[model samples]
Target: MKKYLLIFLSLGVFLNACKKSDDDLTPDKGLTPDSEEVMVQDFMWKAMNFWYYWQADVPNLSDTKFPDTVEGVEAYTAFLASESDPGVFFDDQLLFSEDRFSFYSDDYKELTQAFAGISKSNGLEYGLVKFSDSDDVFGYVRYIIPNSDASTKDIARGELFTGVDGQTLNVSNYIDLLFGDNDTYTLNMADIADNQVTPNDKEVTLTKMEGLVENPVFLSETFEIGGEKIGYLVYNGFTNEFDEELNNVFGDFKSSGVTNLILDLRYNPGGSVNSARLLASMIYGTHTDELFLRQRWNSKIQSELSDSQLTDYFADKTNDGSDINTLNLSKVYIIATNASASASELVLNGLAPYVDVVHIGETTRGKNEFSLTMVDDFEGSYVYNPERENQINPDNQWAIQPLVGRNENADGFSDYTTGLVPDIMLEEDLENLGSWGDLNEPLLARAIQEITGVTGKRGFEVKMPLLEMTNSKMFTILKDNMVLDKKLDINIQ
Candidate 1:
């Protein structure tokens, strides 16, 4: 009787173990947060693993052990359980409404004070902390305290301090404050509303193209050549509209006696890659091997567009006369600055093989890929986060993406981290410019020099440049004029 009881008990334990194993392999429905947690953990693990897989062949984050790295499958499982959720300890009171939150809210404030004290005690620069309302919580966390040790370097974000009591107080910003262009105060914008942040007096001037569609192509002989005409075409922004504009511009440039082309992307914050490709084709006369620009992400967040899968994306583009295999190339001088990014970088990479591309001004902001659109559960709106994208080059390897793929030049040699150094570097003349304009216009002058071989003056000053139409003006005018004058006809007999 004892032997039979033991055998039954053993069988029961075996069955329970088998059921647990089966549960592990089962497909998860969206019924529990476990599924969400698993998805995020899986992505983070894959991201780390991808780094390890490529590290043997690429230049990347050193294989040095991270403080976060864990051992054993169970340990790995436990670590992810803690780290996956960013909103784990969200303060319901401090969310949404601005009035409930304060600079002295919680431990964050005390943490900042402690960090400030440390800075002053060491006689180091008290890193400035600026504060403004922010759309993203994590974004605020990242931009300010990018890492754990960030407080030691700059002013602490919100505040997270050590538990050591009565540590000497370092002088720091009471709250992150926005002050006029001052070196002493690091700008804090974690609290400003999107609309409120936009400067009412801010000026944006557009030239070359005139229409609702933001495709601008302009011609100018303002830049001179030696007894010959050098035409200048400056288009700063890149968009789908710009793509359509490029088709027309390239078609015109081929026919017109336009020997030199200048693309002014100095102030462009970046837009669409389709436009970047279009611009690349116009400059690079032929197709080249894949170019790496940036990374894309596959986040756990649900995007409206995610519902439309990649298979559908390819199919839809086919109907719209887009075949991914083909590209155009033409000779162009792409003007760049530090502000240029993402698709703008794509333009540079795509055109590198075809033209004597000269990147002027400063190094570009190296965001190379489109972000995944994540709908916030609380806000019910879209937010963007970077993603990893694969771009196989002529060497059949990943392109220059920091922390992921290999960084390489067009020659297939990896080293594009500080970004593609300009063929000719020029410093912006801040005294002569109101904003980041074509202060040096080095690319423009170079394009002229390329065609005419004449060295022109260094910087052309524009003191009272035209103020662009404001949103209010545009809106008010539209409201008053129900029918556009161009669209209406007065044909009353």
Candidate 2:
């Protein structure tokens, strides 16, 4: 029932039924789409055709593909019959080939819960990295969610895991081995020596909970370093459910007269775009008149919108009419990595024109587009409407989080497709992954050095910098997505 549905940091849609017959261009495992599936398929195609950002580029989504005549209705029906699975119909037929962020789910309820920061998670947040130049992969625990199975176990942050259930992890079998049906698994522990991984002969077992809700505002504290009040926050997601709590943290920082802030977004995948704006407003001044972000939709959607509807100015209040806690800082220090994406990247991109964001760590996931949560409503646009939930088709509960538009700043710079490059490039030292909030941690320490002009224990240089193959966050229900909390009512019909 929660309104936050951008819980996924990122996900990949896999539908493999090679170039087939003319009508059955992309079937799934030779299965034909039934009548019910065909109905659901109709919604998928219509939703993409009406709202997709790259709708103009995908020829299959052309308006003329199925005309408005009696014969065209029959042709549209035939077109929907080709794909067996609704997901495949969405991925293989409707989506642009370059689209990596658009995704769909069979149950909107399950997906919405995840966006609320609640999911079935073991709570061991980690990143998978290849062993320098080998097929073998290893994982390092980034952080542990409190009240989770991993929190109950002896496993903690910086712990290296080489295998699951005693089998060594490789690129091919890792996905199935970790994310497969088994709810419980033992992580084979290992340690790095001279930059090489060696099994430590220890293991930690963890189990997934049914409804684990993660509070995105992980750690917030204040410290006085070099005579300046420094506020450090480890934010994991931009979940709207925690918007008030997040604002309160900034309120605390403001009351404490914090002059400098270190925003740790190393693992945040992203969430609601509205929450992103609120978080940005919290860091920067709440200048309601100034342009905060600009939206660019498909040509059809663009044509109907006035400039006021597309442009988002920095807000002075939260969506619920609460005054936003303002920092009004001229500069901010951000810590990120390859895992940082969506709303996480939005904070960096949206604030660039105003604030001086000193980015630390590796390149980000580089996702600039924003998505909308669409469900199978009576209308073909499939836009999610809570008031019309009962009107959704009984046979199909399918929902899509499609990239409907891209957000740019006041200066019109939103080309972070490759990723936001770091000004102070630093990677987490696996052998010495420091505890959270530690000023001596490699990434934070660098930021501290920049702020305080004094350094401490900066000896650890990243021997073989780890490039994340994919992390545990990337496989979650949300997969990196920046969702627009407000809905668009463009009349496509």
Candidate 3:
């Protein structure tokens, strides 16, 4: 059955080539020497025309505009030839107002590595902030990946740093100070005196390294409170590479007879959709055949894919083909913020039909769309096979992660463009942030209180620092039109 599906997909691609009407511009075959500069551009147009969710919105992409006629072929050929850089040309063709998640990648290898939770970094995730009513800027550690230099130096989350290499961080140099392409750098610690952040004498040097695999399951533990076993999991991302480890954590929770679950996704900027489905199935053990998420693709590709294939269902197996450890919980407690997006929201929305989801913390990063990593397969380089082994395209490194479909639950409730509002609106306790698994943490404590019927002490009210922008207008413009750092693979094979 899977073999027939692959043949059907290949035939579809061949049919797409027949519509081009130009021998030199055969997209299904490789690109010609004359079209080498704009090969990626041509690929982008054809791929998006077939798969993009907003293909109907883009006039240039419409079949009527670029039909099989002689004039239509000329128009498309001219359009592709005009752009020197295909990445920029592809961006200009997208309906930016509705398509924010689609992106072009110059290096597909790095992007693929990121999907597997492997990347080049110093393993320091931090947030930049400015003091209230002042121009002073600082950054605080969010979390450090284990086995990284930052983790080795004991750089814990919520620890403030005022400068890099003894130079004070300001609005002008903060970005370079934190994210410069340097192998080694010093982070000068800060002292919080009377709510004011100042540079302290302590400093930590960090060395950046390549191929750092991030462990997404940060903390997982089971607690006994009020005679009910409560499980806590601070999951950072939905990387499929860690699916077995995630199931092991759930297996422990199930063994401990956990009745309640607290899922901390405050800083999680989502990942793989298959992992999300596994997580959802682990929570709702009985709904194996129920709809997990329905994908709505463009009209062109919709004709090729069946409704059953497009709709994902709850499965008791991981993406790596391992059996899932089910929890069978009736209710779930999720702590989320604006960073929780993509697959994170999929898990939350998909489980709402069967589970009593108690949401806490700020609103979620409303992203219901998923993207497929599209690489140039015409040259047989970077061609994705079902078996997961493929040759690299060192010459042509262009790839795209386009917003190909929107996600909906079994109830078809996916109107969260503005974001998912929290049932209990409590901001993160920045002033007194505790370790992830500790029950003393404000967000986890609140979830435990809600589960055990005990009132916990509230932390001090701390305002989230805003970006001290030197150019307010530019900042506003960028903020309103920035692509978030959340990607989901729909696995449209």
Q: TM-score of every model?
A: 0.42, 0.90, 0.84
Cα error of candidate 1 at position 111, Å:
32
Write candidate 1's Cα lDDT for 201-306 as tens digits.
Answer: 2111111111122233433233334765344555544545334445655556655655556666654555444455555655554343344222222221112112
- C-alpha lDDT of all candidate models, in order: 0.33, 0.82, 0.70
Off by over 4 Å in 2: 1-37, 69-74, 487-493
Q: Write the per-residue lDDT of candidate 2 for residues 1-493, one digit (tens) a residue.
A: 1122211211100101123444321211222233454877877777677678998999988867666667776677788887778888888888888888999999988887887899998999999998767899999998999998888999888889999998999999899889888899999999886878888889999999999989999999999988989999999998999999999999999999999999999999998888988999999988998888888988866765567668888889986788999899999999998889988998899999999999998899999999877776633236665555686787888898899889998889999989999999988777788899887777878888889987665565887577678898888879898888753323221
**Residue-level lDDT tens digits of model 3 in 1-493:** 1232322133333333343454322333322324456667776776676556788888877756655666666766787877678777888865456776677778776666766677677878776677666666887777888888788895788788888888888877876766667779998998664566767788899987888888999988889988879999989888777889999999999888888899988877787777788898888884677887777766765565557566777886765567889988888999987767777887889899889999988787788887666666643222233333254344566777777777788898888988898998877645666677877877788888889887756643545432322211111111211112222222323
Error (Å) of candidate 2 at residue 60 is: 0.6
The most accurate candidate by TM-score is: 2
Q: What clash count goes with each model?
A: 38, 8, 0
User: What order do you get sorting by lDDT, best first?
Assistant: 2, 3, 1
Candidate 1 weakest lDDT stretch, 10 residues: 479-488
Model 1 ranges off by over 4 Å: 1-224, 227-231, 286-331, 366-414, 434-443, 446-450, 457-493
